[model samples]
Target: MDHQQLLSLLRQMTLDEKVAQLLQLATPFFKGADDAGMITGPMASLGVTEREVRNAGSVLGLSGAQQVIDIQTNHLKHNRLGIPLLVMSDIVHGFKTIFPIPLAIGCSWDMALAERSAEIAAREAAVSGVHVTYAPMVDLVRDPRWGRVMESTGEDPYLNNLFARAFVRGFQGQDLAGDTDRVAACVKHFAAYGAAEAGRDYNTVDLSERLLREFYLPAYKAALDEGCEMVMTSFNTIDGIPASGNAWLMRKLLREEWGFDGILISDWGAVKELIPHGVAEDEAEAAYKAIRAGVDIEMMTPCYVHHLAELVRSGRVDERLVDEAVLRILQLKSKLGLFERPLRGADPEREREIVFCEAHRSSARELAVKSCVLLQNDNEVLPLAGTGKIALIGPFAQSGDILGAWSWQGAKEDAVTLRDGLAAAGLDASRLIVAEGCGVDAPATEAQLAAAIEAAGEADAVVLALGEHAWMSGEASCRADIRLPEAQLALIAALKPLGKPTVAVLFNGRPLDLHGVADQVDAVLEAWFPGSAGGAAVADLLLGKASPSGRLAMSFPHAVGQVPVYYNAYNTGRPNVPTAPDHYVSKYLDIPNEPRYPFGYGLGYTTFAYEAPRLSAAELRADGELTVSVRVTNAGRRTGEETVQLYVRDVAGDVVRPVKELKDYRKLVLAPGESAEVSFTITEPQLRYYHADLTFASDPGEFIVYVGPNSRDTAEARFRLTSTV
Candidate 1:
């Protein structure tokens, strides 16, 4: 049915029925029916009791396509209006076949993979009857200490924009309502949550308009351009106002300025927290403010369910607002074809047939191997060949804890443990010594210290896999200390004197303080939670069949105190002087303020050499575009891929730019002695900035462009922009 017809029918219904449209009830599972006593009742609340479920819409969680089929089948057969519920889940990565987290995948620097990952998520999600996903959290983060940085695609606007469009294409596909296995992607956190003060979750964000436009807004805009159907508000506050209630952001900017017509959903409990943000006086007031501000869906927050109707009945909120929200909700359902053959998409037998199928496992393995960023290698101890005895020491050495946070309902038994991978590598189980050197969080014991040293003694090379536990970093799992916990360092130090070549394989979600490990380990392989087949993937890289090409999405700080360290930071009045160590400069007293590992920092078994960046055209007119080119050659014996990053800095502008800003990047694969010319088209958008008047403008100025393997290693050239704007 058309939205007008659906709205007309909804309008004729009672107020209780209309109110029910706002409530999103939780379901148990598809295999069991609600009346079969499988469902306990409405999902347990953080605080509120189970409200009545009579006219409520439902959101599916942990339930597969079959459950969605059963739920929608029951809704059509029994409900008064036969309004099918919208099924949504947290499809952050690949749905059934888990891929790398957004941060790890971002290192691929491949827009195709970002889009492909999303498409796979959409395909799997649709197969299971999901219509929407709260994913592609386009919050540009600079803080490595903030645990959620693993969920974002790193800190640069240019890179994030490329990722944002790819994510949208993967999730929504060409047609949302028409596709059986595609779900609408929700571009999120409306404004600057990444700038949360002190690098703390839910902390207040205070930024200048110049900073906001320059660093943050581009990704969200990119998602909008890609036809994203929904947007989720952030939990944090911007300029002392809660994002869930910020009309200036949602109404004026999102809906009015950008012309976004999608449904707006609030983050969990964000609407009710307006009182703490000092915006609303009560829950009823919160309802009125958020509804007027253009939030169409209340995710996990009952404030909208219990109070919205009352606010609308009174003069506080316009009734048209309620109708508008309902209309959008119904339209999304219609697009999902939930109203029409709702049961056609779900097959119970097919559900059992395809979850974690071999195809998915293979894809997961490829993603895991590609996601491993080789941070540092000395004397080339890696590419472990020649069939020597290896000591795989550490808790993660045998761990199958590949499920990064917010994972779906899969058991540990289904996971491919690291032990499984080692066996597949044709290594003798008896010869490969194994020892739990220390726990993820506990201090090193004398026994663990002794065992690690003993294992190191008998091995040709020690592969020490060390990193944070599966739960150390993610949403609500934030940490004040980002260093390796437990006795990992002590254990590593003890094993260091064995005089054997040592390789460190880290299974972490976020970047860690690796200064100590860098000094001790001969080689470092950063295998961020590689999903189900992660173990096999790491083994493949270790055996040299696949070269590690992943780069650091976020910078690795030398110490926990340097929480928000990143590459595109501003140039201060006092910079590091080569000879003059200090007076009147932005220098740290104890240690150098440089990051332990810069963003885009990674290593390859082979090496590539890049000629200095050269501009195709010297002068750029306001309307004309020019291509900046660089030639890169693989200088080693083997084939390798290099992420050639392009950074631009405006020497003088209407408003100062970051000392360095990532404008463009290209990942190129070359064989030994093979060379390729890489180029990025420079346009006004890439050169524009938020002016002093709070408007985006392009100014003619001296510009510096750098192109190289990573942020720290680059060659620079200066050019003058003679744009006649």
Candidate 2:
């Protein structure tokens, strides 16, 4: 429908009907649901009625062909205006055919693959009757203690922005209005949710406007720039006001300044949370502030449904506010072409055929291969020969915890175990000995340890599959001590005495402190929760069918004390130089300031040597560009992939700047003796940053350019920028 038609429909809606249109409920509230469910418990608690459920504009956390079809058919029968219900789910990583976690995907540094993952996820979800996915979580993160870090790309604003754009593109394809295979993308945790204090979930976030705009806001803006259709408000506050009720953030900045004209939904129950946030005195006030601040949909709560209509009837709230919110909801359904095809893309047979098909699994396997980072491979101990008598021992040897969090629809029973992967690759049973050394978090039994030792004693080498269970890391799963459990570490220590080549393959969701494990194992592979074909990808990489190319997106600290450790940080006034004696400097007494493995750090089967960067020009004008080129040669015997990272430092700026900031990067594949020249064109606009007063521009001065394998180790060159005017 056009604007006038939508407006006409909105004008015809009664106040209660218009108010109900802004409320989102789950499947259990309605008739014809999968099960015979009722709306008593939650609705009675919040004073919402069955009539409101019938008039709800959307559904949350419910999908499946017949269920969606039944719900929609049942809903339209009672809805006065016959408005269709939008079906939305947290399809964060994948729907059924699970892929690597978002953090692992960021490690791949392959934006095309990341985009393809989202595309496949959309394909699977669309057939399952999902209309929108709350994904492309673009919040920039430096603290891994926040469990949602697994959902974000990483800490670097530039890299996270790139991945955010890719995810939005993949989720909402070019023709979202006409494509049944695509779903509307929703950028989440709007503003700075990742900067939760003390690495706690939903904790308070405090930052200056300059710092927030500089670091946290870029990725969200990038997703919006890529035309993402929806936005979800974060649970935390901006300037002491909850985002769901902050008019300055949602109205002034996002709606007016950024020009985002899409639906803005609250996080689960976040609209009602304003009461507990101490901003609103009661549920009625929560609803009043949320709508006035521009939250179009209230998910899983009755604050909006119970109070909105009354507020509008009274002199306190405006009826046009309710009308505007309902109009956006209508426009979203229209944009999705729901009026024409209410059951858009919902096909039970198609869902069964394509959910976990071989082609989709193959793409998942390839991506998992690129996502496994070889954190340590001392003396070239990896790429195990298939001929050796290998012992696969640990909790994850035959465990099915490979599918990480947010993979609710994924079939854990279908996961390929490590033993299954080895056998499927034609490794004879006689050559592979397997044992369950210990549980992920539970203490190991004496018999289990004895069995593992006996198996390792007879094998030529040992591969210990270790990690956190899928439940340990995700939303509300933050840990104060981000390390493997003691039982798993004991298994590592027990295996170290066998005098055999040992490899520890970790399947986790966040960066862990590997103090005991890395030192004890000959090799450490950070195979983050590698999705469905995780075991197969591990087998391929271990046997040299594929090489490890993944790098760290988030830093792994030496200890949890360094919670916010990252590569791009300011050089403090009293810098802690490694060579200089530690005195009156910003150095820890118990540990170092540097991360155990810095951002962009990874090890492959091969090595690369970098030459000094060559600059095309010594000075760059505001209107011109500066080209930087460098030569990289594979110094090792094996063929592998390397990500050449580009970083820049402002010698002097209007304000303090990070010592090194990631600007651009290129991934390369080289033969044993081959060399390649990679170049990047740096423009003046790329150097612009927000100043103290919030003015965005560049300060003309000397800049140092560095290009190499990772952030820590790089070769440097110099260039200067001069304003054209």
TM-score, per-candidate, Cα-based: 0.95, 0.99
Over the full model, what C-alpha lDDT does candidate 1 score relative to the true structure? 0.79
What does candidate 2's lDDT look like per residue over 119-224, in tens digits? 9999999999999999989888888888888888888999999999999999999986789999999999997999999989989999999899999999999999
Taken over the whole model, the C-alpha lDDT of each candidate is: 0.79, 0.90
In candidate 2, clashing pairs total 0
Model 1: per-residue Cα lDDT over 467-539, one tens digit each: 8877877786677777777478877878887789999988888888886688998999988877778888888
Count the clashes in each prediction: 4, 0
TM-score of model 1 vs. true structure? 0.95
The residue pairs in collision within model 1 are 30-67, 65-128, 126-181, 177-335
